[model samples]
Target: MAITQIYLNLPVSDLEVSKKVYTAMGGTINPDFTGDTSAQVVFADAIVVQLMTRETFATFTKRSTSDGPIEVISALAAGSREEVDRLADAALAAGGTEPREAQDIGWLYNRAVDDPDGHSWELLAYHPAGGQG
Candidate 1:
């Protein structure tokens, strides 16, 4: 079956604090999917992220959440290098920490930022002609 949407579920220690970080990264909260224990952050119509309290998320599986290590790294494609920089700046201004400096590979640019809960996000922009312009 074809998939119309994708939901990335993450466990957070505090919903309100996590909401601020996601909002800074340009995500909107979907009221229909948000509650006291969990909040649904929508990046676009097709990409939805569900942020649940560790306790609330535990109900879905037996796996224990780990805060000391990153289990996943998420990447978002931007329209331009400027857009990627803007997003990375916003994340840092909103209390997210940068894991490393931005990377420029001629045709591609990328930056990584970690949320307050330590979830890693990579913002990237790619140019087909090596950004000669």
Candidate 2:
């Protein structure tokens, strides 16, 4: 079965702050699927992020909602190196933090940013032509 869409459910300490971070990265809030305790941020037709309060997130899982070590790094592909920089910079200016320095290896460029609650996101661009401008 081909997966038509993806939903990333993240438990956050502060719901409003999380929403702002996502919006800064170019996502739009979908009010139809959003409410007091949870929000749906649409990055693309096929990509959606479900940001929920830690208390609300507990309802969907039997596992603990306690914060811990890094569990996942969500990656987004950009059309070019400049696009990657634009998105990452926007996120940073809107209160997100840079997790590391940007990386550029001719064919690939990437930058990592972390939301206020520590959720990591990597913005990347790949050029198969190998450094071709």
Which candidate gets the maximum lDDT versus the true structure? 2
**Model 2 misses residue 121 by how many Å?**
0.6
Where does model 1 exceed 4 Å of error? none
Model 1 TM-score?
0.92
Indicate which candidate wins on TM-score: 2
lDDT of 2 by residue, 71-113 (tens): 8999988888888889899999888999799998888899999
TM-scores of the models, in the order given = 0.92, 0.94
Model 2 TM-score is: 0.94
Give one digit per residue, the lDDT tens place, for model 1 in 6-39: 8999999889988888888889999999999999
